[model samples]
Target: MIRIVLADDQAVVRDGLSMLLGAADDLDVVATASDGSAAVDAVVRWTPDVALVDLRMPGLDGAQVTAEVGRQAPDVRVLILTTYADDDAVLPALRAGAAGYLTKDTTGEALCSAIRTVAAGGSVLDAAVQQRLVALVGPPVPAPEPDIPDGLTTREVDTLRLVAQGLSNQQVATRLVVSEATVKTHVNHLISKLAVDGRPALVAWAWRHGVVH
Candidate 1:
């Protein structure tokens, strides 16, 4: 079963989300929070597989809760739930290590599926969110980008592009015709050179600076 914790200042929203998720056979709404700090505390205590968060909560907010949870328990993936998809909320949420973002209006089915996807180490970039990522990232400019970093081989660049295209680690290895271990090595090297900690950062960096193109 996928354990979940929900954090939203609004009681109605929390109740709705909890009921929606609880109806799923494979999902358990272990707890719910009315504030960001409580969300952070619950995440550390229960260590849910995923957290559904509201970006505008009074204390700490979604970004801070996500960051704190990531620092204290990185295994608990964060999924931001906001009323709007604006950059004001989206970019900061992603930077804080949230695995996905969803608006309040999403269907029960979609929300449940997103939880499953994020729990399995995948992001749910809604169509609007995908465009937001590209827009906020600006554009590609390869010139003078990280010196192509000393350790990255030509094959690694191909691999990086695939990653920027949203492929999982296993998918990257298969696409590059190499073992997962090889892909892990390349990815580790890339992160060290670029100084990024997660896929969202790597993707934004590669897309914005033309590193992967």
Candidate 2:
């Protein structure tokens, strides 16, 4: 089972999430906290696989809690579950070591899946949150140099740019006027050529290498 520590200031939200997560056979709510400090305490005390945290709470807030958990219990993955998806809220949590970001509007199934993904050392960004991040970063503007790095094909470069912009594979496919499977193929090629572990690393690599501005 994937052990979880749920943290939300609202009692109703905490109760709802507890019930929702309790329904999953592979998920168990090992602890719950009503504030950011308590959330950090719970995570440190229980060392759950994932900490489902709210964006705003008294004492520390989600980002602070994430940072604390990273410091106190490095094995715990922090997943931000909040009502706000704006840049101000999303960016800090990510910067502070959150492995996933999902708005409260996410379906219970998706929430559980995100928890599992985070616990498994994967990152999860809600579709809406991804769009917000993409918009905040803006579209890619290629550098003036003509030669591509790593001998990447023009199509692979295109895929890398879109992926760096935080577009999902399906969204990238639609933007490129290609099939989703084709986009996935391009992504796989990019991952291999760029030597990145996954999509999140791809985004970081793109920014670091100026693949996307």
Q: Which candidate tops TM-score?
A: 1
User: Candidate 2: lDDT over CA atoms?
Assistant: 0.82
Count the clashes in each prediction: 0, 0
lDDT of 2 by residue, 93-176 (tens): 887888888998888888887888779765688767765665555554456752357578888898888877766676788999
List RMSD in Å for every model shown: 3.4, 6.0
Candidate 1 stretches with Cα past 4 Å from truth are 104-110, 122-124, 142-150, 173-184, 211-213
Model 2, stretches more than 4 Å misplaced?
A: 142-213
Estimated TM-score for each candidate: 0.78, 0.73
Task: Summing lDDT over every window of 10 consecutive residues in candidate 2, give the lowest-scoring window.
Answer: 139-148
